[model samples]
Structures are given as C-alpha cells and as structure tokens.
Target chain A: MKIYHECLPCHLRTAVNSVMTMTEDESIISEVVEKCMQTASRFRSYDSLLEIYYDIQKVVKDAFPGMDPFSELKQNFNKLCMDSFDEYIKKINDSSDRFETALKLCLAGNSIDVMQGIKMNHDVLIKAIENALKQPLNKKVMEKLKSALQKSSNILFIGDNAGEIVFDRIFIDYINSEFNKAGHITYAVRGSAALNDVTIKDALMVGMDKSAKVITTGIDMPAAYLPYCSKEFNEAYDAADCIISKGQGNLEALLEENKNIFFLLKIKCNVIAKILDHKYKVDEVVIEAKTAS
Target chain B: MKIYHECLPCHLRTAVNSVMTMTEDESIISEVVEKCMQTASRFRSYDSLLEIYYDIQKVVKDAFPGMDPFSELKQNFNKLCMDSFDEYIKKINDSSDRFETALKLCLAGNSIDVMQGIKMNHDVLIKAIENALKQPLNKKVMEKLKSALQKSSNILFIGDNAGEIVFDRIFIDYINSEFNKAGHITYAVRGSAALNDVTIKDALMVGMDKSAKVITTGIDMPAAYLPYCSKEFNEAYDAADCIISKGQGNLEALLEENKNIFFLLKIKCNVIAKILDHKYKVDEVVIEAKTAS
Candidate 1:
C-alpha cells in the first residue's frame, strides 16, 4: 500500500487518461500531466499510493473545476449495469448459492474502471461472473464472514465505483434478505468524486440509499483512508460489527485496521497481487473477510 | 512534429522503462521518474517531442553514470539482426529490386526499438521486411530519391537506433553500390548516448564508419536538431546534396528544414500518425524524401 517503483508510470497513465477525457488542449494536457508528476514527487515515503492519486485528481480538478470528466463514462457504465439488474436479481434468486453468487457479483463489479484493464460490457461482466463462480474464494474467510454476520446487528458496506455500486446494492439486499439485517446497514461512499469512485449523487441515482443509510468517508481519498476522514465516518467505522470493504483501494487503506473487515475486490496491480500471492491478472477476484477481536 | 497531447503519457512511460532497468531501489526509481517529469515539463512549447525525451534521458544519465540503461537491450537487438544479416543480404542480392529490398530492410530495422513497438527477434524482423516489400512506397518520393542520388554525389545519412543502424548500413551500402557513390556517404550519429541512439562507438561496432566517414551531430538532442549541433556537423549537413533522415526523431527535428531530406522511418505515435493520415498503428513505414530545388 506504500509507494512502489511501478506506481510512478502508472500514476502518469492515470493522469493521461483523465486529462485525455477532460480536454483536447495539448498545452493543458502537458501542464496537467507535469503538475500531477510534480505533485506526486512531493509525497513523503510513508504516504500511501492512494494519496498520490488523490493529489493528482486535485491537479485535474484545479485545472478544470466542477466538471466531472468521468461523468459521461460513469453514467454509461451505471446504465449498462442497471439495464440488466432485474435479470441478474432473478438469476441470483433462483441460484442455489445466493451468498456466493452475490459475493462474486460484487467482485465482478470492481472490474468496471476504464483506467484499469477491465472492459465495461455485458459480455465482459458475464465472463467475469462465470470466472468468479468457478474460482474458489478463501473458504476460511468466507466461513468467518458468515459466522460474524449471524450475530451482527449492525453492518457498514464501503462501496467502490459508480456502476459497481449497483452490484453492491444487489449484494446488500441479498445480505439483508438472507441474514435479515435490512434497517441496520450503513453504506459509505467518497465525500467527492475520486477517480471513478461513487459520490452522493451517484449513490442516489442508483438508489443505493434506498435500503441502507448512505454515508461519506469525507476524506476524498480514493479509498476510505481513515486518518483523514471526518469524525462521522470514523465513528461509523468503529461502530459497525461487520465491515465489507470494497475494491483494492479500501484494502490498501484499511488492511491492518483494528476492526472487523472483509476486503472484496479484484487484484488490479502486481504489487498488491504479489502481496496476496494471487497469481492472477486484473481479471481475477478475491474475497477475504476477517472479524474483530 | 510539434509536441502533441498524446506525447505526454509516452514520455513518462519511456522514463519509467529507463529507471526500471537502471535500478531496483524504489526510492531512487521514484526520484528519477519525477526528475524526468520535471525536466520534460521545462521544455518550451515549440520543441519537438524528441527534445522532451532527450531531456528525460539526461535525468537518467545523471542518476546512473557511465551506463546506458538500454545498452544490453541495444546489443541484444544488434546481435539478433546481425546473426541473420548475411542471409538478408543474400535475399536482397537475389532480388530484382535490390534498392527497394534494402530500403524495406532499413524500415524493418527501424521497428527494433523496445520503447517503440518492435519486438526483438528474426521473426519480427522478417515480418516487418515482408510487410515493407508488399506495402507500396510513396512512389513519387522514391523516384525523386533515385533522381537525386543519380545527380548528386555526396549524401548525409543520419542514423537512428543502435540495432536499427545495422539495417541502415545495408541500405546505405545499396545506395553506394547502385548510385556509384561509395566514397561520398557520411553517416551521422549523436555526440552522446541519447536513449538507444547510436554513438560513434556503436557505429564503429556495426562497421558503419568503415564504408563512410561516421560523424556526430555534436548535439545531445535526440535527433539531428542542428541548432545545437557542432560546427563540423552543420557544415556537412549544409554541404550534402541529399540527406537521408532515419527514424521519427530525425523526422520530428528535420521536417521543416530547407534541405533535400529523405525522411525514412515509421510514424511511431498518434500525433504524428494522424498528421500523416497513416492508417496503420506503428507497423507501417513511410518514405518521404523530398529534394530542395
């Protein structure tokens, strides 16, 4: 989760993807890319890679304010997933392994970011779902999550991206229906737009707040990096008995936190993938859930 | 040839590849990458894309002294081509169009840079050669080059990369033999190691200086940017009746120069690629040798 050598080029590519979509002005593109690099160069050795991207995001925001460069992309992705929501729900409803299906569905959702390798299409989604269903989850951790959920009255589900949130809604609904804790769930998003991560508007659009109380991390970091979060999110993080941390970003920021947490995400980069000993490309998903002492 | 928006990300990737090979130390890697970014950021808007890379290269050299990060890669490519070079020559000799074959071989060689898309191997080289032969040259320009070579005695041939220089030697030899100007050729290289560009030592290694007087641009810029060239190179460039500019770097720098320059290279990027209306992605070769009347 700390800065890796490979992270440098990756940061440049991300900024390039952002500015490329933002404007066609060559000068602005050059300046924006340089600004991102210069800003990242100032990051301390202890700073997480998440902070580096967050700072770069600021450079883009400052250059062109109030315009979400990924707005159209996010909307398109949301619609793409939502268009098949009912069919997917019916498929899950009829499936023998609803929990496993929902968990895999959540993992497949993390594979939506354009900057990342995952392509956004229905076939790609179906492929990911099939792959995840066949791929074994960490059985011990899954058992632990199920065991914890049996007694837990309150839960916090930290969601990842915009379109991905639609999948999370399905899983959360499944969790509430199967485990029967509908009214007690708290869903968290970023305080503002961070990469393709969801905000309040996206959550509302997808009606993610329909079943659970929606909250913000308030830190604006890509993941829910807690040290910078507002008092409310931190209190919520402390109060939740079972926490479902979505995406690699949350896993990075909250890996060693003294709380009950489950990291449900796709291993996107080699650095973290190596750490997990996950010998798969960005196409693979993993589920690791641990309980509080 | 001017700086393009697409060029920003590419420059970062080049620096990343350089630093990745230079050292494994993450801190140093991060530092060097940032330095390259800062160095490239300082380049004036009017500077060609090649200058951006040249400056970034300086950053790498400063960090790692007396070592060409691409030295091993360059040598491997040279040896790879040189291993089958005799066979290639035989094929060219057997062909009815020795000049065209040699010219395509040279273009195929241009595909050798790792930063650029050419994979290092005989198969890739052979494939490139086949594609070049089948693909039609700018016929009008090729005819003009033939006419210029017949009328003019002295030609300045600017070489590009180290491995690609081997192919350049073959084409130059064909020019010398066919045009009966064997002693009238001067092959120019960079004064210092700029990326994978050939220096006098590399030229000598490939025996390029043996047939012709091998000279330096006397400038550390990526290509023959004559504004910074030594007095000797400028005189040679000025006096030559025809100039054969190899590689996109040379094309970017020499495009607007008022000289009878034959730009023999592949369009590597979208910015220049779009301008040429070149439909292929980094695989096609372009022959644009215009005589200054």
Candidate 2:
C-alpha cells in the first residue's frame, strides 16, 4: 500500500527505534534520526512505506557496521517459539479442525514482531494465541482458502518474522499433509535481516524445510516488492496457483498484485486496518482473499 | 529543553496534526509534511524542540497563508474555560486555602493543550481540576512561592495556553488581593499564535488586563526564549523579584535561567518528567523553585 500522511510519523518512529536498538549513544542516534528525516522529506505520497523502511535500515546499518539491530531479538523470539512449538502442536492436534487452528496460530504468531515495538514474551504470545483462537475467522474466506489449497498445484507461503515462521511451518505442514498432498508448498523468507523477519537461518532453525521448500526473496527488505526480489522468488510467485501472504508487510507489498492471494494477518496498525477496511479494527485477525483482477 | 530522540516522532506527528487542522487536501498536507521533515533533518542534539516546532509552523503557514490552524480549537477552549470560570471560583471560595486551590486549578488547566493531542471537553477538564485539587502540592515549594509572592515588588507571570490563561487570571487575582497587594504583576504571552498558546488577543479575550498588566514576549514561538523575546519582556523578566513560569513550555525555556523562578506546571511528557526529576511522573503537578545561579 502507498504511504499515508499518518505513516510519516510511524516511519520516523520506526527509524528512531531501529537506531536506538543499535546504539545508546545520543550523537549516533541523533545523526541517524536526522538522516532518516532527510530521507523522509523526499518521500512522495505514492511511495511505499516498506521501500522507505529499507532506506532507513540502510542508514542504521551504515552507522553500526556489520550489526543486525534486531539480531538478539530475532534469536530470542525464535528460541521462544521453538520452545513453545510442542504446546502449539498439541493445541492444533486437539482441535476439531486442525487446519483452522494452525492458521489461527500463525496469525497469532504475527504479534512477535519487533518492528511494532510491542514488548513480547512467551507468556504474552501464548495469551495472544489463545485469544486469537477464540476469535472466529470469516467462514467464507476460510473455506475459499481451503478449497484453493485442494485445487492448486503449487502454493507459495510467504513467511514474515522469525517466531511467526514456526507457526507458519505448522500451517504449511498441516496443508501439505491433509489438504495439498499432490501440490508443492514453497516458503519464502527475506534475503537479509529486516526487523527480525525470517531469514534462511531462522527458517532452518524453526524446521520449516521439513514442511515445505524454503527460499529467500533476496530483496534485502522487509516486504516482497516483486521487481526488486530475486528471479527465483519471482518465478515461484508467478508460477504459484495460490499465494498465502503472511503479515502486514507482505500484504502491503502484494496488495495490488493481479493474482489469487489470501492474506492472513493481525492488523497491527490503523493504516493497514483502514486499507483493508475501515470497519476492521486494529489487532483484528483478518482472512481476506484478493482474486486476479 | 533540548530535543530528545523520542521527540522526533512527536515533532513530526504534531506537524502533521497541525497541517491536518489547516487543510484536508492530501497533496497540500503531503507537501507541508515533507517540508517539516526537511526542516527536522537539520536539527542537532543541542536544538530546542520549541524552536524546531516554530520552523514546522512556518512550513504550515507558508502552505496555507494567513491561517491559524488552531484558531477554532483555541477559541472553543477559551470559551469553555471562561464559561466554567464561575464554577472554579465557587470551588476556590469553598476551599479553606483559596490561593492554593486557585494555583492547583491553574495546573489542572494545562490539560486543555492541543499539542498533546488529547481529546478535551468540559467534563474532562472539571474532573482533572478536581483530581489536581485532591493531589497534594510540594509544601516546601508552595511555601517558597507564597513567601516570594509576599516580598516581591515586581512579579512576572509567563502565561501558557488560551484556556489555561483564564485560570492564571484567578491565581493572579488571588495573589494581588490576598498577598501581593503592593507588588506589580506582569503577565507575559506569546507575540503570535503558536500551538494554542496565549497571544495578546487571547490574553485580552480572557480579561487578563483587569487582573494584571499583559504584554507579549515578541517571540512568536510557544516558549519565552529570552534572547528572542521583546526588550520590554526582558526588562520585566530581569527586574522581577519572582517569576511564575506557567506550564511545561515556560519551564523548558527558562529551566537554565539564573533567576528566582517558580515553575508551576503539570508534567506533560516523559522528556519533561526526566528533565524536572526522573522520580517525578507524567501528569504530576509540580511546584518547583529555582533560585539564581
């Protein structure tokens, strides 16, 4: 989605927060913030926030060389999710509809996002998962997604954050085992570190390869802006009969794509919530399908 | 006070909000926001937020010529406070210590600030006043102020916002009648419109002239930065035996000033809270005395 006036402050806040995560030095933080503002000054209303965020990441990377600001956070959350994987698996196994439960779990896992600046812990994640499960998903959208999974020969499941990838694996595994036995499932992660998003290392750590084929978008950004992504990702994106876009970032990047895409996300901010539908409140679990236009 | 990293987003948010108040045109808003960002990019660690805010306001004023973005809100809040003046007077009269009650009411009136982005109404302000009255002021600081008021030959009361100025009149009236009968009181307001802060017109609108001599600082910004203020204000500021710095803006601008200034304000943000004393909490009414260095 294109940047909104409201997104300007959010962009600056995210830039400041990312820099803060890298260093406590006031001079360095001020310098980085000033540069981010300069970058923001040039932004047009038509500019995508995700692309601009990549520029902000570049500023922070330049300030603190060879440092992934969210590295420790990514590792911590990945470990947290991995440790809780057995509990989630049991919850899915105990549910009447395993696919639905796993999908909800995946949506719940989106809360582990460091970019949102939410203080996340295992207890908080567990509580969020339980709350998400209690909230009902749109039956029509759910049924459409299930039907698509059954019919599609190839499915591309784009992953988001590190901890969330563990839950994505569960959903992918369930779909591969029960619904899409004849189809191939491909999981796409980010090429480089982008606000605790899943990388090849995180995907492997979460045992995602056991469920589906893993690949990187190679865009070195948070979102899969198709033109900039690796040829392999574009091929997978184009060849896929069905696309499962996870998290707000991916949904924002691919919102206007003329393809069969199902969006599964917890609306993290008012900007995305308004874009999807004004009636959809922030933190609401959204299951929406955007068919080829 | 010098700008904090946390203030960067706040500054951008305020600029956007102020522009939004002026015009609904998306392109106009975008253009103004971009300009504000450009101005912010040049900000150094030593830069005061109030000064940067003036530049942001300039961007907005340039975009929408001869417009006061907060005119309606300021007028509304001023009328609201004026209408409720009698009610506050009655409460003060009913209290044993009328001066202290009036002082607390003035601190509570700080909540009507538009820059804080808090939704304000009559009921909210009334409840806030009641709460402020219930909260105990620092006795030692209050005693110091009272003692200063009794002895001072010339008192300079720097006013803050439009709605809050009505409360300032009450406190000034009380001090003149009960303690500082022989002393001269000078009320200082902003030279022009700056984020709903009291201007010469607002001061007159609230009947400030009847209570004390009202003068503009000649600095168009919200804060009374002495170097930029009028010669008349500087002379009054220097000659005053005691200075009553009202609200966070005045406190911030004059925090380092070597003078007998008593800062009477509601701690608005964490930045101010830390500046005053890290132990102090946001929304706490502070009565602090700073003697000449």
Off by over 4 Å in 1: A5-9, A16-38, A44-46, A87-102, A116-155, A178-181, A256-261, A264-293, B1-9, B25-53, B90-101, B116-152, B177-181, B210-212, B264-267, B274-293
The C-alpha lDDT values of all candidates are: 0.79, 0.84
- B1-293: candidate 1 lDDT, tens digit per residue: 56665566577777778788878887788788777767756655546667677777778888988877777777777777778778878979999888778887888777656666456677877776677777778778778887887788788999989888888888888878888888899999999877788888788888887778899999666689877789999999999989999988788788878889988887776666776665545556778765565
TM-score of each prediction: 0.82, 0.87
Cα lDDT tens digits, model 1, A139-224, are: 78778877777678888999889888999999888888888888889999998877788889889888888878999999666789
Lowest lDDT 10-residue stretch of candidate 2 chain B? B45-54
DockQ comparisons of all candidates to the true complex: 0.30, 0.69
Interface RMSD of each: 2.7, 1.0
lDDT of 2 at B185: 93
Per-residue lDDT of candidate 2, residues A120-227 (tens digit): 787788787888899988999998998999999899999889888888888887887787553499999999887788899899888888888889999768788897
The residue pairs found clashing in candidate 1 are: B262-B289
Cα error of candidate 1 at position B174, Å:
3.9
Candidate 2 C-alpha lDDT tens digits along B18-38? 888888888888888889888
